[model samples]
Target: MAFALRSLLLLCGISGLLTGVWSDLKVVRVPSCPKGWSRLDDRCFLVVDKLQTFADAESSCQGLGANLASIRSAVEDEVVSALIARFASTGYVWIGYNDINVEGTFEWTDGSPSVFEDFDGAPPTNPGEDCVQTYPETLSTWDDVDCDTPSPFVCAKDLH
Candidate 1:
């Protein structure tokens, strides 16, 4: 009888935990993004209107402890595109993707995996045009341009 009673109490305790009837736990707040930056998921994004070469733009982002924005999924692509449309000047904006190391093999400046591509038409057919940009007017589709070309850019950093 005692064993059965203990089992019943244990079951009730576990049931209370699963049902969230115990209110001893404290709530943890999510970290906030920097001022003027937009928060999405676990990242913070900022579109800079200043025109700079791809390398220079990346350097500027590094100064802020961020990397050039890397779009890893279609959802991220849309969010970044919206950020550009809202905050950046009307033109192509530099992204972190580039084939600067080897033609036809694109990689993100932040060393993220090249998992998604949103090209406007063709997928980077122009050799020596290594840097990647998104044309906000064309559904925010991507294009490869000369790395030396000056353009606005997006920067991304972790919320932490």
Candidate 2:
């Protein structure tokens, strides 16, 4: 009986390690053109890189059958940020968040903003950067950046 318990514990540990490894390896996935999509965690996004301007990129996302990726939680925010950092997007992209409402407050098109934030120790710099962008963590994870600069944006959806 003890041997069996030990074996079971070992198996569970191995499974946990494998799961971590899998997540580490496949941090981001971009769907193929025409029919491919990128997936992070339980959400998926489509990227159309050929366009210029945040509006153009947004329209491009809509044309591809997806809206700009919206981060709702810290995890999703981290993931999106990672994607941006991996691709080295220095500017800003039109994320799902825009202050089209007031001028300072931002909300995702999904109707809510992710509780995540990327300010190191200070709040955002300018209200003009009211739009949202994603930045990466130590490796690559989503952190909020200004959306007005025109970095490549990510569009994501739940796989219902």
Candidate 3:
């Protein structure tokens, strides 16, 4: 009985050691958003109140290792719009959706597929209005405006 007890103790010790080593080898990393940015699942978003043209807004976002926000779903649209309303107040803010390269074929500046669109009422038929902007007060709705129009903007980046 004493020998069996000793064997059981030794087995438990070995099992504990293996578990510790395995846990040490499998270090898990936690994702986080940068300061002042909000996290929605795997992505982080930042709203800049400074007015800038579409190109300049994209440039600013790129400088921060991000891009102008490409809202892909209604949930994302709602969250982004809420962020704009909270941080940028009631106004239009530049998003990444645009049709500068091909009219009527709007694409995101970050190269994300334009999977979702929440245009406010009728879509723009103006030839010169290539960029897109979202008014927080209008909820998840968007509108097309000239790329040169100055507006506050949102930036988004994936968490590493």
lDDT of each: 0.90, 0.59, 0.90
1 against 2, candidate with superior TM-score: 1
* Local accuracy of candidate 2 as per-residue lDDT tens digits, 1-160: 9999999999999999999998888456644433456576666765444435556666766776667777666676665665565554363445676665676565666665457545444445465555555445343322344443456667766665
Q: TM-score of predicted model 2?
A: 0.57
lDDT of 2: 0.59
Off by over 4 Å in 1: 1-27
Pairs in steric clash, model 3 = none
Candidate 3 lDDT tens digits, 29-105: 89899999999999999999998999999999999999999998889999998888799954799999988888888
Tens digits of per-residue lDDT, candidate 1, 22-106, equal 5766789979999998989999999999999999999999999999999988988899989888888766899999999889888
Cα deviation of 14, candidate 3, in Å: 10
* Alpha-carbon TM-score of each model against the true structure: 0.81, 0.57, 0.83
Which residue runs of candidate 2 sit more than 4 Å off their true CA positions? 1-35, 87-92, 121-125, 137-148
User: What is the alpha-carbon lDDT for the whole of candidate 3?
Assistant: 0.90
| C-alpha lDDT (0 to 100) for residue 80 of candidate 3 | 93
Strongest candidate by TM-score: 3
- Residue 89 in candidate 1, Cα distance off native in Å: 1.5
**lDDT: worst 10-residue window of model 2:** 139-148
Assess candidate 3 and give its TM-score to the true structure: 0.83
